[model samples]
Target: MQRRQFVIALTGLFAAHRIAEAAVNPTDPIKIEKLVLSDAEWKKRLAPEAYQVLRHEGTERAGTSPLNAEKRKGYFACAGCDLPLFLSETKYESGTGWPSFYNFIPGRMETKTDFKLILPRTEYHCARCEGHQGHVFDDGPKPTGKRYCNNGVALKFVPA
Candidate 1:
């Protein structure tokens, strides 16, 4: 093969590999559902932050979550559905205010592009009920190379 043609072929192969690695399933449509809570019941159930992020798609300030320093064997549940989504073993200190996990229990969460801050970010919600949780990122401890950074307000940690 000609040198120039060989380089072009190699470049195409590399690009294909990267694309395959990055491909993820499209999130299901956000389905609107009636709240399963009475007004007083929801108010009593969630904190202010939890209400905003889980019910209203709000983001919390970075580096402010106590979960960043949390070190315990447990499962993290969606504050919305109470569904288990992450293991404490996957958690990491991403210094991003929320709880950062390297991976999730597959198919437990979904994503959409968030333009709330004038920038595009991949925002994820609980797959069970489509409750807004938080964003995922490329910046994370390796192996999976995914930072499933979740809003501390959107999760409730349960000790094992």
Candidate 2:
């Protein structure tokens, strides 16, 4: 093979390999198709915070989530699908900008690395509609050792 051709082929092979490694599980490609809502409809359906995060992919101010102190028996549903993602029992105080939960209802979220903060963060979005909720961090009380920090704007509290 010519030197230039060999280099091109090698580069293509490397690029393909990198792309494959960067992809998440095909079965869990952050399914957000189910959560799309009309702007006017969402305006009437959601509070300002919920609408921002669930629809517009906005983030709430850190330490501003009332859910941080929320300690009630209820279900936390997606602001988009009303799909239950976390139970009240798993909720905890992470003192983060969003609600923190130790556990999820299972298979209800998809996570991707976020670089908006100039640091790689595990940003999780609702699995049903791909709404950006918040980032997950490792600093939390243990059982799962995973803090599912969620934007209060992306969730709806349904009291049980």
Candidate 3:
């Protein structure tokens, strides 16, 4: 009984430590230093398509992203600043012809209302570089009913 009690106490301590770590949110843009760069610098650092998507808020054609077919274990990070945005496990086939995710890494993205399409949409960007990644919608599977439709050109996959 004492041993079980000790184990429970240790588990509680571990859980508390993890919760504290989560509270800090290392990727939170307000807390972490943001990466700012000039247009020329960004152009030089990224491909033409990546620049259009990440810097100019351009969307790639639907069904055109190779990342849509990606199935290996990896992280989809911002092509502009290499910030991990989505985990492989969170990825799903939303049939939106994009690399879709059910969730994103906490604090790695920020959202703003966009009206470019004549309708309001929740567009999200990378917290580190403020690069455009994609938009989030309410249509998604369980646990979190949010579909983050992302532009493939704006991301680079990193194997875990």
Ranking by TM-score: 3, 1, 2
List TM-scores for all candidates, in order. Answer: 0.70, 0.69, 0.80
Q: Where does candidate 2 stray beyond 4 Å? A: 1-33, 38-45
Best of the two (1, 3) by TM-score = 3
User: What digit string (tens of lDDT, one per residue) describes model 2 on residues 59-123?
Assistant: 88887766777787877877665556788888987755568898876677888888888989998
RMSD to native, candidate 1: 17.2
Q: Cα lDDT of all candidates, in order?
A: 0.72, 0.71, 0.83
Indicate the residue-level lDDT of 2 in model 2. Answer: 100
Which parts of model 1 are misplaced by more than 4 Å? 1-44
> Per-residue lDDT of 1-160 in model 3, one digit per residue for the tens?
6985676556556544543453354234334336666698789989999999999999999999999999998778788876677889999999999999999988789899999999999999988689999999999987899999999999988765
TM-score of 1: 0.70
lDDT of 1 by residue, 68-148 (tens): 787898778777656567888899887667789999876677789989899999998876546688888898888999998
